[model samples]
Target: MNEGNTALTWHVDLSDQKLPRLLLRLAIPSVIGLSINALQQALNAIFVGSLGAQAIAAVSMTMPIIILLGAIGEGIGVGTASFISRHLGAGDEAEASRGASTALALAAPAGLIMTVALLAILRWVFIALGASPTILPIAIDYATILLPGSTLMLLTIVSGFIVRAEGSTRFSMWTMLIAFILNAALDPIFIFLLGLGVRGAALATMLSQIAAISFYTGYFIKRTGTVLVSISQVSLRVDLIRQLALIGAPATTTSILAALAGMFLYGATARFGDDFIAAVGIAVRILTIGALPITGFCIGSQAVLGFGWGARDFARVVKVAKLMVSITVSLSVVYSAAVVAFARPLVKLFSDSDNVTEIAVLSCIVFHLFFGFYGIQSFVTTMLQSLGRARLSAVVSFARQGYLFIPAVLLFPGISGFSGVLASQAVAELGAGMIALFVMLRQFAELRQGARDP
Candidate 1:
């Protein structure tokens, strides 16, 4: 068979695979990739933790801003993935290529603009993010290297999503693995041997991201994938951009809201002391690491659901969603139990301070009590995006971190003190999970009806 036929066969084979096997095939690599990424973050924290509480706090302060920068790329990536997968499912490779190309073309400028704009106001931004005076300089040192290199990060993220949408998840996994391994190796060398401290950690991350984007560049350049993204195919077509934006806006808003919520949480925690800030930081990192499997599965399922929806195979979509929800919720429960069971030991891994350890332990247990709620929220959000229900997705996204979380974080701490701060996320997750369940049930009904209709 010709190469064209081979490509078509590959795409068709993805849709033909058994549901359980297909999801596992896709999700396992993503889980491994994301887990490694999370492990790297944990390692970064440990490396910085040795610098003292102030160093940890400084690095933590940079997180919100870094997340804000990441939001752009993630939004674009999600938009590109959804657009490409659906088009490919419909057997329009040209459209898929065009959409992918347009997204890639847009990523660089977006990253560049953010880098310049953010660097200009770095100090003020950190101050607004509640960085204490002592932590401000270290935060600046870290972000300076990171912000400028974010363009590479954007390219790497968008490219990974593009390949994953094409069911080339192993390639996506390799990219992440390469970056993580490199970052892990460099962390000690840069941070300690080189005495760069927080700045060294930032440098390692930037270099690793650079390597990742290089791999992506070579993959696309070699045209090793079915969707060939090239500058020649790039288009500034208004409709395509609008379509991307429609899907992307909600994802971007979701991330931006999380960043804003982080800022608010940091500010509230700061009122207690730098130790509290450090404790919250460690708890956040641990929770993030723990959530990787659920998130990885949700991400993997996106390609499957998008393809099914595009093919008008409502049964497949429904089955995938059901299976995804079951697995993710179960994983959340197990992870939450494990974390609660060993919260103190986990907290001690990052710090030796009795005060920091105690606060982090409490934060871990409180933050994860309703984590199964997060599983529900995450899957539902991914389901909506995959099905092209942009408006609904946007609403659900805002409800969690925006409407619900912002209020809880703002008011709860005042009502209950530090304990209230710890409780805010759990409360928000519960509320959001209920909202997500309602929406998801409605979705299931619609999908079932669609399946029966013609």
Candidate 2:
């Protein structure tokens, strides 16, 4: 079949299917893929853990930069996916293909710029973030190695998102799984056999990204769907770029804010000691793992929502959003309970130090208390983006991670010290989730009323 027909065929289920069933089809594979990817992170931490607390702390210090880069890729991905799905829904295959191509075009130069900027500021950045002399050198070394691989990283991230947009969720899922597995296999060899230490971890991650990029490049070459990632097709269309920026800038800012939030938390914890920083790092990784299912569900659901909105099937959009909320809430409950039950063991998995283990355990349990309601915000942000309500979605997204969380991290600790830090996240989540609930409900109401009108 032609690419346009292929795109339409892929979307048939999205428009005609039941919401719960569709979500299941999308979420199950995505969750599995994301879960494995989370596992790769945890294992990377584990590999670094064998070196020492300082190594762990060093990696922790650099996480904001790492996440910041990821944020850029994810933002672009969200923008690209939104545009592609919406265009595809409107039966505009050529435009959808062009958007995907433009995203890839944008990734290379952005990655190059990020690589240079990060390299120049590595030492200065980490130092400002409160890295001690002991951790500074290691942080620099690890970050220097990782920064050069930014292009591969961006390619992998954007490609995966675009593939998911094409209703090739399975392809996206397996791509991540393959990369996760590849990273896992390489970690030991590079870290131990070659004695690269923290640098090895960076190399393994970079190599894994290259593997993912290769898979995606192959996907485009075969032309299995409407979305084509081709250099020749990448046009400098000001309108498409503007649309993408409108939708993507907020998403990017949200991630950037998250990076800043990490810096804020890391800086705040610095007052206590490296043990605290290391503990927080471990706790954050665990939280990422815990949050993966919801993340995957939101990702999968966003594509579906975008398709519905593009088709002007507002009823389906609202129905799917409602079903997603129900599902996310259920997942949150399960995840929160698991964290509570496994808090000690999970923290223990990372460290044997009494101070580090105790602090990590407390933080994990305390930070996750409001996690059961986090899906409210995730659903709202993704739903807004899908519906092309970028500004509102951006506001909601900002509130969840940066606006609320940043201030909370900075101010809360003064009230209770470390315990304050732990509690701050839950407080932010409570507030953000409430706001998201309000926004989502109001939007649905408006959409419903509009549908009812003649």
Candidate 3:
């Protein structure tokens, strides 16, 4: 590697570092990164929220699916980062570069295929997701802009993770910061001032993503010593595909499950009224704002655990896992409190209807009941993935987003009403958190025992 490449590293050797200090170093930057990205999306909702419930609902209706979009991209990113980080930890620099190359080579085409497929399924999917005719056009506009942009978006995600794997997260942080600022600055002009409404909002967001992808791509050019694998090297290398799919597919699939869960929830809420579905949509965005810290902690754990495992430090893995749990729990409490204290106003910030406000208030409270579990679930799933236990992560993901969530949304709402639907996610989140806690505890015990035995 070139001297410049080595100098760019944060050199986070998890085994040699103290957990609290290391986690803070990683989590603070990651949290900021997560916040900026989340803020970009939130700006869309915030702007639409001012347009009225129909406008908000039009956007909210697509949020779940949009998350699915991100998940596919993120799955690829995670797969690449995990492999690269391990190779780097073992001091195999050439292998690391090759892995990074494979990731980029694989992601672009995969993204193209995903986009084409999304295009074919767009109309039917929206209709199936309980989007009314009025909302269908809006969904198409937003989704279409996202289609061609998927490759860029996916590239940015994978590139960011790769750029930071050796530990200098500044570029990742900077890219997101710029993207969010651009997104924020443009939201008002394109969405409000331009008289474009929802389409404008979607376009503005896509442009911001273009900026992110450009910045990320530039880093690999003559700077990282070698670019993230050559596009020409793209192939169905079984080992490379296997490693990426093993870790990436579950996370990606779980995001799909969340989308499915939303459909189920929306169908159930439809029984109450269109306004109710709109209310839940706003409630979710509000909830996501508080989950940022939870996500940050989980990202840190993945990095910490992955780096620790790379160095073959079983004790360090355990320490990092514990650190994730502790940080996740503490942040969960703080976030939950803030959400509860300002639930009404927070909802109001995105929306302006009295009926929507009332429903948002009740649902927001129900959301808060399970809010404290968010970070715990993230910690469990991410740590397992970091340890290369993809199947465990998959099962845990299924339990939380699919099995538990779908049932609760369906059965509960059938027996009661919209109230039951609101309560369902809480039950699922709480159940997932408990299961994650148990599984992680067992893993920690295993790691500690290995340390003692050796």
**Taking the tens digit of each residue's C-alpha lDDT, what string does model 2 give over 132-182?**
888899999899888899888888888888888877777778888999989
Clashing residue pairs in candidate 2 (N, C-alpha, C atoms within 3 angstroms): none
Count clashing pairs, candidate 1.
Answer: 0
Error of 1 at 174 (Å): 0.9
The regions of model 1 sitting more than 4 angstroms off are: 1-12
Local distance difference test values of all predictions, in order: 0.89, 0.86, 0.76
Candidate with top lDDT is 1
User: Mind sharing the TM-score for model 1?
Assistant: 0.97
Number of the predicted model whose TM-score against the real structure is largest: 1
Q: How far is candidate 2 from the true structure (C-alpha RMSD, Å)?
A: 2.1
Worst ten in a row by lDDT for model 2 = 7-16
**If scored against the real structure, what TM-score would every candidate get?**
0.97, 0.96, 0.94
Pairs that collide, model 3? 101-229
Off by over 4 Å in 3: 1-16, 225-228, 232-236
lDDT tens readout by residue for model 3, 418-452: 87898898899899888887887788888999888
